[model samples]
Target: MSWGVATLGAPTFLTIGLLLARDARSDHPFFWPSLLGIVALSNAVAILRVNQSHRRAAFARRSVLALCYLRAGMAAGCAMFVVLGWSTGALQEMVATLAEMLDASAPAIAIVMGTWSLALALALAFGLASFAHAGALHAWIAFRRGAPGPRPGA
Candidate 1:
């Protein structure tokens, strides 16, 4: 099974979601719904991957599945926080901080704000995934390195 295919879809959706959601004009027909859908789908895939494998393959599968869940969950949650802020008027605070720059030059401000938001979203995704998989890193390596063998006493 190609783990990369399962892994790539979630982040791609999330990155696009966050970028689209950040726009002030974000009711752009596709942003918010896409974010929600991608998040739900990513979690579904993670759950499926974790449960689908046999016990003997569980150790190898667990790391990837766990990381996928962690990444999707954290990134989606953070992006949701930003959306919640938009809905609840907390985004006013963010806008206030950017007001001067935005007034002076809208494009630069947009670039800066968008980059900051997306960078943090990506960081949260990567950091949570790394932490979740850290303990299993060596186990995965050893599992792959060990020679094939019959069941003990079989």
Candidate 2:
């Protein structure tokens, strides 16, 4: 259930972050750093909460699950970013610039840029998706604790 939630939630959060970052790029120089800080704080809080609630082994498992979700989210988010860029001709413009710089063909430049963009997107998505997953899990944990029924994991 967590995996399913992360699979959908991570990409959605990442796409939103990308859009916000794109908008902030033109105006706010501090946006990226501020966003990164927020994500870091969120992850820290989530880790601490999980650590306090579970044994070491369980914490490790949860950590691994979160990492897996983060990677999946990053890949999905990057695909979305590429599609959006292509639709907006942003990718073409970037490719054109790089192609001129390296005297390469447009297709080659596109492939290279696409690869680079994936890497870049992965880095950006790491924090964004991590925060999303952590936030989601945190909320879930809170709900589970508040519910009247017995807790399976607890």
Candidate 3:
């Protein structure tokens, strides 16, 4: 597995940890932010690999699959983080931030974050699954293209 795929494990583990350590009024945020940062950096590396023209032919199909899988993992991890964040008043913080930016109150902020998180989580799930499917399809195409020619008749 590429380093990009390998690094996704960190975010997944952090999200699991956050879920386990949920507290409504905790002062310190879980490692979720660092998890996000790590995933983002991994994706940046993958993007740079894809953008390198010299390496394009060297990794055409593999690169595409890696990128798709990376995106799927990233979306799934972030969605899971949001779900875990909601448990730790990060949801509240998110709402407060939005409300401050828009000049509103807590309840209004709750409604906004609640709805947005729900919609965004569902959308992320859908996108992640779709990207995974694309990666599978691409893999199948590559496999078929690389098959050995038919054997000669007896």
Each model's lDDT comes to 0.47, 0.48, 0.48
lDDT of 1 by residue, 5-108 (tens): 33334444556556665853553454445444544544444444444432335444545545545554555545554565456544445555655444455578
On residues 1-154, what C-alpha lDDT tens digit does candidate 2 reach at each position? 4433433344444664677667756333443334344443444444455444443334334445455434444444444445545555564565556545553455876767765665465446554644546544644543332225567888
What's model 3's overall lDDT? 0.48
TM-score of 3: 0.38
Q: Candidate 3 residues 1-154, lDDT tens each?
A: 3333444434343454466458433354564454455354534443443334223344446555556555654555555555555666665565556545553455866767766765465435533532334334333333222335588992
Candidate 2 local lDDT, residue 82: 50
- Steric overlap count per candidate: 0, 0, 0
lDDT for 57 (candidate 1)? 56
Q: Give the 10-residue window scoring lowest on summed lDDT in candidate 1.
A: 134-143
- Comparing 1 and 3 on lDDT, the stronger one: 3
